[model samples]
Target: MPLATEMFEGHAINRSAAERRAATLTARRSVKKLHQAAWLVNAIRCIDLTTLAGDDTAARVRRLCAKALNPLAPHIKEGLGLGDMRLTTGAVCVYPTMVRHAAEALEGSGVPVASVATGFPAGLMPLDLRLAEIRYAVTEGADEIDIVITREHVLTGNWQALHDEISAMREACGKAHMKAILATGDLQTLRNVYAASMVAMQAGADFIKTSTGKEGVNATLPVSLVMIRALRDYGAATGYRIGFKPAGGMKAAKEALAWQILMKEELGREWLNPDLFRFGASSMLGDIERQLEHHVTGRYAASSRHAIA
Candidate 1:
């Protein structure tokens, strides 16, 4: 799995077929009542609980960590009949500067600190600077590093450069898990997305993500389908399971359920866990919380009622 072009040379993504399958995913696997509630709860546990912004602060990160520790209030958990089932977001994602604050706040909460590195959102910085950023975040106590890929490599067909860069990043990460952000919205074609996904997995990414949330089109079903198919193919051939994360524009409970259904149908039940899947979302948790409130009380609450932080 050392950046071989042959692995994806003949690989072609049928856009229409992928679209059809993505369309049927939600329609065929619609859940309701208790099932919907359970899926939402699972979504909460698989969320990265992210907050990556220009204005992110230590105080904001600490609050986000607190929320990750106790995603649902005691009364809300009791109302949902959760009993002793512990619920917590998979991790708390932040910018490199906020990694230590988040790690310190989440110290013994069983929640890992995820830092968006390699010049996240745009990733236009030099390679050395990007790798150094990853190392800096890891040194600051981040257990996971979400690194953005060089889109120019994909756009210019420089697959080897992309592979080498990602492989280097994986090495820089040391023991910290590495998530390769493809920024599918900027890749321009399903074929490019498919190729990028394959290259990232081959380069040793623990997770292949869809977007950085800055692109015009972020995390669409068509794009996710292409990426997940590549993940399935990689797992089948290598016997190594790579995680998938659909970041950006996912802000509703139903959307979360849709992605879950896609994972269940494409990768089976095993991929539906936090170890293999994650939602790189911020406002999404608020909507899921609102839906959970409705599930327990039978009445929809306003968005303001379920604060994300």
Candidate 2:
């Protein structure tokens, strides 16, 4: 290809991206201008409370995080052995310290590890500290690092601050994939999630994970729906097929399946895999087992629950 031709192609690509973004905004607004959800689902998600039974108040809150896989490993392994049939390719994401636990628990099991960092649930710490945490986790064998955005800054409309944090975190990822968590519960609006998705993708986020699975309100179908749409729009502009993950409070098999169905319908079969899509679930694994077993076997097994780590 000629140098001028290459340059022209790049410009055309850039312009086309801008137009797509513009169209998305117009479409989103038009849809919202007339139709919007009158209510948010107040129905409680089936999150196992054991995660919340931590040392103190903060520890208890942190415990609400979905890293508790020790109890659910065998079911996951058995479910994987079922082969060629699953609602979706399932993987377990745990905290950094628990990576080895999850790794050993999932050995030969094929499920990947996604570690939380950037002072997850509270990005009030220094950027260097956050980046180092990300680096250390990857070094310790994390397949993915789920870093929360510096919401204090992003919410202030500091796009540059937001961009730089994501850029640096992405660099710290090394060989591991980077999943930028917007923690949409804290972001508080669809507009914020949409814009944060754009910023993270441009800054090199490998995947745009929706929450910390902290039960902090970040993971919702609608919130994930918005972020996925934004990621799709950005990919059309920048040629990066950014991934999407809705991690928190996704405990029921039906809920996870609904998300998967939406993902398949919107992003195509390519996003149906664990690479581009995942449920950061704690209690949903057993449900998946129940689902698969009931389908493959005649009767559901009472032993379908976690084999007790």
Candidate 3:
């Protein structure tokens, strides 16, 4: 199935050139608001955590990035409050090299392993190397694989090449889920994000993700909205329920809440499950604990309640 370009069926109807342009603009803007709602809703409501701490520990960022996710993954929901919101047992993520480490850290727990691959943050490696990395990650017990597309392909107008590569990566994930990271910051346009989302889905990505957590454009609501809308249309057309993952820059519980809202408006109840939605963060767990505590006790816990792996 060549990913359907008919995602814009309703908006792609025959019309005057001006009308077509207006519809395109209008559709883009509408898609824009759906994402805005994701952020806005977060400001209002709930999560696991969404921080990578890449900046907080420059000296130990590499080791810290691997360790930060450990405590959260061991017992994500263990310390959760009795309040209305929910959280993961732990949102465990690790470098590609540690897929097994992450797998061990999360062994019996329900927490799943999300391993980054494909020369992430800069999908410039040869396609053969990227697939091998993905295969190794999945074999090492990664439940999910996050791979980056060739940003150059999307920007330099080599979309066909990009599409072909994404298809290969998706097929490489025999069972584990595939999350295609757009690195939307590099694309620099919502229109491009929308188009890329469509291409990724047709190519077989199980989830459409934002960013690579490299101090670049780490996940934005608007970017998510565009992708989700395309996914929504993709689902309606193909009956395929794709998933979404937002990584980087989510550190607070409040931000998680907004993502919930974004899911509601764009993807709806069909995707509220952990299978359909997940957030990737490095330093977000402990803070989620603190936020949950604050919501209940009026005053925050004086000490950190985060569990150490």
Candidate 4:
């Protein structure tokens, strides 16, 4: 698809209405009992279980891959009356250096390997080096590349620069899908988030991510709502549906439900799948498993029994 340069030519966001709608969403809908359980299961499917750390090793990546493949043990699946359902996370995310380790470990598991690249957590590197990092991750068998945009471009009102930079990163990804992380917390305003989201999709980002999980303020309801609306408008204009990922600070199962509700309410039921929506989460899975266990046994399971790593 060609870039939708015209779509974001004069984009603007209504911050107050966005925040009010975000607040109203939670108050309007409540999923409980079997509905909540089912949503939690869906959350499991849409989780890009992540392990990005300094001490990450081959052993740790392998263990994380194992957990991704069998997020819900057979007993847990049976307990939920989903004996026929073989649930797994959407993908396993690791650093660029660990992409190969994750790829080899997750072989035959049907989970794509996602790698954080372009000097992730702080995209302050030169454009050439950042693009090279994306290609290297793709070569290492990463099925998805999560690249952080140059926040300076958005900060300085340089939409063209941001679009060109992300376009280059998307091209570097080649066959692998590219996810543009907006790091909304650092963008200063909801308008910046909206503009950044539009520029990323216009530049061919397969998904627009909320944060890098390292920022002081990661994903939040209001930020996510603004981005999702941008996605909706972009989809309407270009007819190319983009995906959304809300990362950071979303740990509990209830938080997962809140995001799911937001997606279902804002974008409709079609956005509930792993292809369209994903939670860039690590510890969130542990809490989801605990909740699932409680749903089955009518009691909470020990945290040890549902360890993610």
Best candidate (score: TM-score): 1
State the lDDT of candidate 1 residue by residue for 98-197, as single tens digits.
9999989988878999999998888999999999999999999999999999999999999999999999999999999999999999998899999999
- What is candidate 1's TM-score against the reference? 0.98
Residue 49 of model 1: what lDDT? Answer: 92
Off by over 4 Å in 1: none
Tell me the whole-model lDDT of each prediction, alpha carbons only. Answer: 0.91, 0.59, 0.64, 0.91
Question: By TM-score, how accurate is candidate 4?
Answer: 0.97
Model 4, 1-309: lDDT tens per residue?
444556665666777988899899889999988888899999999999999999999999999999998888677798778888778899999999999999999888789999999999899998899999998999999999999999999999888888889999999999999999999999998888888899999889999999999999999999999899999998887789999999998889999999999999989999999999999999999998888888888989788677557
Cα-based RMSD of candidate 2: 10.0
Question: If ranked by TM-score, best first, what sequence of candidates would result?
Answer: 1, 4, 3, 2
lDDT score at residue 266, model 4, on the 0-100 scale = 88
Error of 1 at 192 (Å): 0.7
The C-alpha stretches of model 2 lying farther than 4 A from their native spots are 1-90, 104-110, 297-306
User: Could you tell me which 10 consecutive residues in candidate 3 have the lowest summed lDDT?
Assistant: 43-52
Evaluate candidate 4 by giving its C-alpha RMSD to the native, one decimal. Answer: 1.3
| Clashing pairs in model 3, backbone N/Cα/C closer than 3 A | 41-258, 42-258, 46-257, 50-251, 51-282, 51-283, 76-89, 76-90, 77-89
> What's the number of clashes in each of the models?
0, 3, 9, 0
**Root-mean-square deviation of Cα positions for candidate 1 versus the true structure, in angstroms:** 1.0
Candidate 4 clash pair list: none
